[model samples]
Target chain A: MKGLLLKDFLMIKGNVRSVLLFLVVFCLIALEGNDFLLFVPALISFMMFMTTFSYDEYNKWDPYAITLAVKRKEIVFAKYLGSFILLFFSLIITFLVALGIGIYNQNFDLQKTFTLLLGCGASILFLQDIVYPLFIKFGVEKGRIGLFVGIFLLSFLLGWILKNVSISIPQDIYSFVVSYLPWILAVFLLILTIGSYEISKKIYTKKEF
Target chain B: MKKILEVKKLKKSYGDFVLGPVDGSFPGGVIVGLIGENGAGKTTFIKSLLKILQAEGEIQFFSNKKEDIGVVLDNSFFPEILTAEDIHKIMKNIYKNWDSSLFFSYLEKFSLPKNKAIKNLSKGMRKKLEIVTALSHHPKFLILDEPTSGLDPVVRKEVLDLFLDFIQDEDHTILLSTHITSDLEHIADYILFLDKGKVVLEETRDVIMDTYGILKCGKDEFSKISKEDVWRYSESRYGYEILVKDRDKIKKKYPNMIVDKITLEDLMVFVVKGRIL
Candidate 1:
């Protein structure tokens, strides 16, 4: 598993110039008070993680990797581990940049910034939980198309719900839910990520080279 | 002799193609040549043994640990963007016994640039790199699928020499699948021929070359030969050619007939194209 992680990092290292360029560009844009500051880094990190799958598919590496003295589940776990590490680093870097920009503009609200970063992190995790299993089952190319369609449908459903449904909540109940929202979201994301990992492992173990 | 690999009733099927029910116990310290035409299940058999594909059967390895086996597949490898140096680093972690010095020595001997990505290297160079990577771990068993396909004659000979050197310990074994039968004639101790997923013939090089013969005779002359001795026969404008199992016996019985030694290529052609008795 360590070897697999090293390979993914080395492959990502090949594109270091582009990654740095993107980070600098996004930082400059965020300094202009763009609301997309958190989203940009999160999306960039996810895309970087997806490129590893593309490289693996292009090289047909899985069959050869299977011949190595490693378990099938380890291979799946390694990908998930790589994603978490990438997201962790991205979260830290994005938070620092947001903090610097906020301080420079004289409106550095630590609580607001922390909450926004947490939401961005959770969104990225949710995207991974949904797409990793698709990639495992249908491969990167087909899975990418599937992801686009899934996102479109999900947005359409959300839009329909917002326009058609209205729920009245008491002021006390709304305040309680908002106060505990982060913890609730964290627990939900954890369960979903675990379920996704198990599903991906099952797909991989039964897969023929 | 100790068996390095044993397979019993191993089988895989997809669509219209089915790969085995293959049974064989390959001995250590010998190079076994697997020969067949296109779509003859050579790759499937190799993949099954490696567990790269799901198959139903019993497979036992004397070493028991996958770390002791090395593999060089024809179509799959590291991403083309990675350099040879990267492969060394990655493999060092993957294989517990990977020898970096030996790997670099092979790269130097092959004149492969450690910094160059795989896409920049020529096909032959890429093949040499794969072979060296497989050998660097000092594995007891090597499973090679067309490891010599794109190589020049000189490089092929050099790689063949490496295989010879590897098996000197008498605990190492190699199973090589190739279209180049001539290479097998030079280094292979035994030949396992597959035709349409079935093992048509398996024998030692000496026995195959010395005992199997092609008898050239006219129709009238061929009629006198025993049908039981002939494996297959083909007729041409000039005469009829028959493949016989015991050449010496046929030669002794028909002193006037011409019975010539058979090569692996000739044997494959006869078995695949010749009419059955």
Candidate 2:
């Protein structure tokens, strides 16, 4: 597991210069915006995760990795671990940028801005959960359709949540729920992430290369 | 000799193309070559043995753990974006027995630059890098899938010598799949011939080279020999060229006939052209 992580880290390390450039550009833009700050880093990190698979597919490394003494399950786990680590790192960068903006703008809405950022982060993660398994089941070339489908579904879901999800509650209850919504959603995403891992593991185990 | 690896009733299928029911074992201390024509299931058989593709059968490795066997695949396993030093880091965590010093030594011997990414390396260099990676792991068994395909004659000879060096350890064994029958002729102790997804013949290299003979004779002389004695044969305007086993026995039976020794390439052509003789 450590080895797989290190392999991915090194692979991603090659893109660090571009990634830093990405951060600088997005960070500057983020400082001038609100919840939009979270969007750039999260998307870049997710795209970075996706690019690693293209590398894997181009080189046909999975077949070679399977030839190693490691267990089939560990190979699957490594990708999941690497992607999650990326998401987590970018999540921090995104959050810090969001906070820096909130601090800059004296009229900051902690509850609204934080919740919006959390929603964006959750959507990106959920997309990763689906995109990764699709990539694993069908290689990058074939999985491209699935990726498009995933992106469409993600956008549809985000749009649905923004417009259709409305609760008719008293002011006091609404305030209570809205204040704790990020925590509740965090736990929910954690469950989905585990379920996603299990699903990916099952598919990966029976896979040939 | 100890049997280091074994396969029993192994098989895989993709609609019409089926590979296997292959069963053979590599003895503990020798280089074994796997020979076959294109689409002869050579790659599939090795992939199945490694469990790269799911197949039905029992494949037992040297240490029971499949990891003890190192592989030099036809394609580079690490991303072409990675350098030798980068792969060294990746492999350090992948294999328990990966030896950095041995790996670097081979890299130097092969003249592979450590910092250069794989994409920049020539095909011959990539093959060399794969071999270097496979050898440095100190595996008890090495599974090579066309490990010397792009190499020059000089480099191929040097690599073949390296395989010889590996088998000197007594515990080391190799399963080499190659098109270069000449290389096998030089280094392989055993040859397993595959044709249309079947193990047509498995014999010691010496037995195939010394005992297996081609008896060039006329139709009348060929008819006298039993069909069971002939592995394969073809008729030409000149005469009938027959591949036969038990060279001494045939010599005794027909002292007037000539029974010339055969090479691995001739054996493969006979097996595939005649295809089940």
Candidate 3:
């Protein structure tokens, strides 16, 4: 598993120039005080993590890796672990960058920035949790299509709910929900990621080549 | 002889092709060359043995752990973006006994650049790199699929010599699948021939070279040969060519008939293309 993770990191390192260029561009855009700072870094990290699968497919590395002494489950687990590590580093970098920009602008809302960053990080994790299993079972190309359609449907459902229904919550209930939202989202993310790992492992274990 | 590998009732099916019911026990310290026509299941059999593909079978490797096996697949390897140096680093962690110095020595021997990405290397260079990686781990068994497919004759000879050196230890074994039958003729101890997913022939190289013969005769003379002795026969404009076992027996039985020594290529063509008796 360490070998596999190291390979993924090396693969990313091979394209470091392009990755750095993209980061620089995103950082400049993020300095405009837009909410892009919250999500762009997470999205960039996710994209970088997903490209490892593309590299694997291009050279048919999975079949070759299977011939090695590594277990099938370890291969799946490595991808998940690599993604978490990338996400962690991306979160820290984004926090620092947001802080620099916030302090420079003299309107630093530490609480709001933290909340939005957590929400964005959780959203990206949710996306990964759903997509990893799809990629494992159906491969990267088909999985990308599935991801787009899923995003479309989710947004459509959210739009319909907002447009058609208005709910009035008691002040106490609303306050309780708002205060516990981060904890709720964290727990949900944990369950979803674990379930995704289990599904991906099952798919990979039974996979031929 | 001590058996190094054994398989029984092994089978795999995908799409329209099915490979299977294969049974064989290969002896240790010998290089077993697997030969077949396209889609003859040589690659499939190798994959099944390595568990790269799911197949139904009983496979037993004597005195060898999974980690002790090295593999060089034909079309699969490291990602194209990775350099040879990166592979060395990755494999050092993957294999408990990976010898980094030996790997670098092999890279130097093959003239493979450490910093160049795999995509930049020539096809033959890539193959040499794969072989180098397989050898550095000190595996007890090596399973190679077309390990010398793209090399020039000179590199091919050097690679073949390397295989010869690897099996100097009587405990080591190699099962190589290749289209280059000439390489097998030079180094293979046993030939395992496959035709349409079945083991048509598996014999020691000495037995194959000494016992198998091609009998060239006219139709009238061919008619005199017993059907049991004719493994396969093909008719051309001038005469009929028959593949026969026990060349010396047939030669003694018919002193006037011409029976020439058979090569692996001749044997494969006869088995795959000639009419069965």
**Order of candidates by TM-score, top first?**
1, 3, 2
**TM-score result, candidate 3:** 0.97
Query: Each model's TM-score, in the order given?
Result: 0.97, 0.91, 0.97
Residues A51-124 of candidate 2 have per-residue lDDT tens digits of 88999889988888888878778988888888878877887877777777777876566666666667767988
Q: Write the per-residue lDDT of candidate 1 for residues B222-264, one digit (tens) a residue.
A: 8898889789998899998989999999999999999999999
After superposition, candidate 2 runs with Cα above 4 Å error: A99-117, A150-177, B218-228, B275-277
What are the per-residue Cα lDDT tens digits for candidate 3 across B1-277?
Answer: 6888999999999888889799989888999999999999999999999888889989999854667898999899999999999999899888999999999999999999999999999999999999999999999899999999999999999999999999998879999999999899999999999988989898999999999999999988988999899999999999999999999999998789999999999999999999987
Predicted candidate 2 versus true structure: per-residue lDDT over B217-258, tens digit per residue: 997887787778888887789988888887888888889899
Model 3 C-alpha lDDT per residue in residues A1-209, reported as the tens digit of each score:
88999999999986678867877887788778887656777888899999999999879999899988799999999999999999988888788878878888888888978987897789889989999999988899999999999999999999999999997899999999889999988989999999999999999999987
lDDT of 3 at A10: 96
Candidate 3 CA-lDDT value = 0.92
The number of residue pairs in model 1 that clash at the backbone is 0
* Model 2 chain B weakest lDDT span, ten residues long: B268-277
Which parts of model 1 are misplaced by more than 4 Å? A164-173
